[model samples]
Target: MQRSLLLRCSNSIFRPPPNSHRLRPPSLKRQSAPIAASSGAQLPLTFSQNYRTAPNRLHCSVSESQWKQDREMATADEQQDPRIARISSAIRVIPDFPKPGIMFQDITTLLLDTKAFKDTIDLFVERYRDKNISVVAGVEARGFIFGPPIALAIGAKFVPMRKPNKLPGEVISEEYSLEYGTDKMEMHVGAVEAGEHALVIDDLIATGGTLCAAVKLLERVGVHVVECACVIELLGLKGRERLGDRPLFVLVNST
Candidate 1:
């Protein structure tokens, strides 16, 4: 069975780059989780226990008038997510990114907030606590932010999917098209074993070209890519459609 996830994207990665070289920060120290599970299907999240307050026309929690005002925040996940509002505010969207008029969903805002940063990593661990995830593959380079820590939490190895000609080894490569042009991503052939279950991650999904390429690279090695996890998702671009059959998941989404 496919597992359902509620996402609250952290906005630290979307910050306007001060320097291209310093795009990603250091690896996070592993933290202990208050959970015990080996697979996602085995983990059962109780909705009643997760929601703090009931939704209704009440002043104490949320009033009908207030809900009307916050209509932009009416997605299924946002409505029930305990961390939606906080994470949304943490994500600072810039007016133009890579070009003009493109409001990029940045993760740097969430990275700066210690509370949001840790919560994002910790939350990922909880959701996949039960999945017998053998490896956590982070796409260069933003995926490195949360992927390593989550891997440590679940006792998994951290792997990298880097651009072509970067990894100095016997690499297996796959070519694909990006939003701008053609591109390629490669992984070390020895990095993953045949039949291993891999969880691919990235900071965000826009056109999904890069992710599709990474999935293809993993499949060539006979690795079973159980799912893909990303922090933010820009909807209406058909990003999810690019990833067929693979479980594409996001913490926060903006259409």
Candidate 2:
């Protein structure tokens, strides 16, 4: 019975319902507010938020083409945030492990680096702390690594979304597709109360089927899914597109 449900869900992946919105990658909007560090915090010397070019300054005068070139260079430089670079560097990539031609983004390397792992959780905690999230629902396995810390830091309940039959009592499950087959994810029947706001956490999103199933399961139980968060995103697969209207946040994007 579970297998049949998963098969049906897998079929729906190819045929998205009409009127679904195309999911675009999240954009970082530059804030006009001046960047300021916390009290006693030392800012990175290489980058300065106070740096500005004025028309009156001798070095500020440039032709239109040069100005455009400078702007492009600045944009490129902005993409390499020091924190993100550290996090990305710690991830180990293994090629063709499960199969040929697949480059896996392994977070175990990040986990090994104590500083990097704490930073990973700290980043998520800082983002969600002020969002009033009542529950942090973590996807099975990898999500467990990141979820509890964030839940504890943000003062929210941690709910584990598990595989079929993993939960002891009555459970609600959602079937989703994988590259080879379909699988079902389950959550305890009373893990979350109706109208509670939740955030879903996962290590990465490849095709987004697991995250989608998670959202469906939570919503089915009347919990409001505020957003989905992941540590990394595989860009070429375009998994973000599969999640319609659901906001996704990730620390790193890799090919």
Q: Residues 143-188, candidate 1: write the lDDT tens digits.
A: 8888999999999999999988999999888888643456678888
lDDT of 2 at 52: 10
TM-score of each: 0.70, 0.69
Report clashes for each candidate as comma-separated counts. 18, 0
Model 2: pairs clashing at backbone N, Cα or C within 3 Å: none
Cα lDDT tens digits, model 2, 78-141, are 3644566667667665433345334456678799888889888988888899998999999988
Give lDDT: candidate 1, residue 199: 88
**Cα TM-score of candidate 2:** 0.69
Over 4 Å off, model 2: 1-81
Candidate 1 ranges beyond 4 A from true positions: 1-76
Candidate 1 lDDT at 60 equals 24
